[model samples]
Target: MQLIFDTLTGNTRRFAHKVADLTGVEVVALADADPRAPYLLLTYTFGSGAVPESTAAFLGQHSHWLRGVVSSGSYHWGESFGRAGDVISAQYRVPYVARVNKSGNAEDVRRVADWLQTHAANAAD
Candidate 1:
């Protein structure tokens, strides 16, 4: 498994680290990723926190799982973060778990770890 990000202020980077720590997954910046990895944790802040331009472009050009939260900061208040994730999930046939934190509280990271673990276990089964 791999955790990929196009972080600016390290908020996304910190979240990626937490997911790696929990899952023992390797971390790679989007630019250095292996396109063939079966599982990918794509993290970015977007929409009010919208997705980074590079990350969005990458998603448009490549097919991968986009795990973790999708909103910038207002996801909890009936925002469209999950909506954006749904579009990607449908297009890629990849499952997405959407989370939001106005305070950068690591909720999305934790949820991503949990989602990855579940997928890993299911794959083994």
Candidate 2:
């Protein structure tokens, strides 16, 4: 799977890169991501549970190939934490793979990697 990320503070990018390293998935920026290929989107949620404009626009154009979504947000947001993942997952009918705080930890990477690997193995069959 490919890792497509959109970030302003680089937290999402860092998490995406970690997941890419763990899963051996190729990571790319939202703009550089291939729309024709299936990928997992890693993005940051901003104020009021809103997705970044860039990520939304990318999804607007390329969501057909979207496989899943992972969102990064501050835990301080409470109920709003990572809500963008929910919206995007519902919007595209893709899995909400994970909600990571800030840059995420090793366990976050492992969780996402495991989820992707499960689907990857299933797809191969």
Candidate 3:
């Protein structure tokens, strides 16, 4: 599976690259992705739990190959923190892989890496 991502403050991008480094999965920006291959989306949540308009637009046209989602946000948002993952996961019928705090800690990377490793074969199909 590909690692597709969108970022504003670069936290999501950093996280995506870290995961890619561990798993050797290809990583691409939302604008650059082909979306013909299965991918896990990594993105940042915008205002009050809203999905970035770019992400929503990308999904609008090419959600068919989406396999899962991960989102980045501060914990301060409480219920709204990383809610983009929830929204995308529900709308696309894919797993909500993770919610990372900012760029995420090493443990967070490890957990997401493990999940990606576990699901790699499934996404290939």
Candidate 4:
């Protein structure tokens, strides 16, 4: 799995590191990802519910192989509607998991990792 993000305050990056630690996935800045690998965009939401400008630009540049986007922080009303990148997954998909926090704890990340593992295993069967 490839984790991509454009972090300004490092909060998003800090959570990405936790994801890497749990899943052993490579964490890459949006500019450093391999275009061929499946991608998960990690971005922060602004008050207007827009993805960081840098992240939006990165996504525009590499619109290929973008499996899903995971936005950190609350979104403004009508902020995240209709933004699609192949497939979209969010906290709403799995309510059992907790949202990512600045403390570097992400139940959702672990849930995603486990879900991916199960999906891969099922595919092999």
Candidate 5:
């Protein structure tokens, strides 16, 4: 599966690429993505746990192929932190792979990598 990302401050981009480097998943920007296979979306949360408009637009076309979601947000947002992933996951009935702080840490990368390895393939079925 591909790793598609939408970013405002580049944290989601950085985190998506880090996950790509570890998992060998192809990474692409939302603007360039036309996913033919399953994919995991990584995006950023905006005001009051809202999903970015660009990401919402992308999902409008591509949610059918989505297997999971991850999102990045500032930790200070607390309850709203990375809530975009939760929103997308619930709406699309896909897994909420992670909610990362900023660009994320090694542990976050590892968890995502593990999920990609173990769960992403199953999603295709």
Candidate 6:
């Protein structure tokens, strides 16, 4: 699957690039993505479980191609951490594929990579 990221502090972008490298998939910024191509969104949460406005805006016109979402956020938010991902998943009817803290760890990458393998294979069918 294609990867697209919406980043503010670069964490999401870095994570997306890492995933792209691991999966050998192409990645683009949300602003630069092809609206018609299917992709899994990588983004970070905003205040109190809010989706980033940039991601929301991009979804406004291109959500037809959105397949899943991965999110990054601070753990300090407790139960609210990564909650924006929940919102997006529910709103878009896509899977909430992964959640990471800050830039993510090796385990996070593994989890996402594993998911991509299975998810993509399922899609191909």
Model 3 residue 96 CA deviation in Å: 0.7
lDDT of each: 0.58, 0.89, 0.91, 0.56, 0.91, 0.87
Off by over 4 Å in 3: none
Q: Which residue window of length 10 is worst by lDDT in model 6?
A: 116-125
The digit string of per-residue lDDT tens for model 5 on 54-91 reads 99999999887898999999899989999998899889
Q: RMSD in angstroms, all models? A: 3.6, 1.6, 0.9, 5.6, 1.1, 1.5
Alpha-carbon runs more than 4 Å astray in model 1: 45-50, 64-78, 81-84, 102-107, 121-125
Please write out the lDDT profile of model 2 over residues 15-54, one tens digit for every residue: 9989888778889999777666678899989878998899
What is the TM-score ranking, best to worst? 3, 5, 2, 6, 1, 4
| Total colliding residue pairs, candidate 3 | 0
lDDT of 3: 0.91
TM per candidate? 0.68, 0.94, 0.96, 0.67, 0.95, 0.93
Model 4 worst lDDT window (10 residues): 85-94
> Per-residue lDDT of 9-125 in model 3, one digit per residue for the tens?
899999999998888989999989888778889999999999999999999998989888999999999999999999999998998888899999898889889888888878756
Q: After superposition, how far is residue 23 of candidate 4 from its true place, in Å?
A: 0.8
Candidate 1 CA-lDDT value:
0.58
Better of 2 and 6 by lDDT: 2
| Model 2 alpha-carbon miss at residue 24, Å | 1.1
lDDT of 4 by residue, 29-69 (tens): 87676567665667665545455667767766775655556
The count of backbone overlaps in candidate 2 is 0
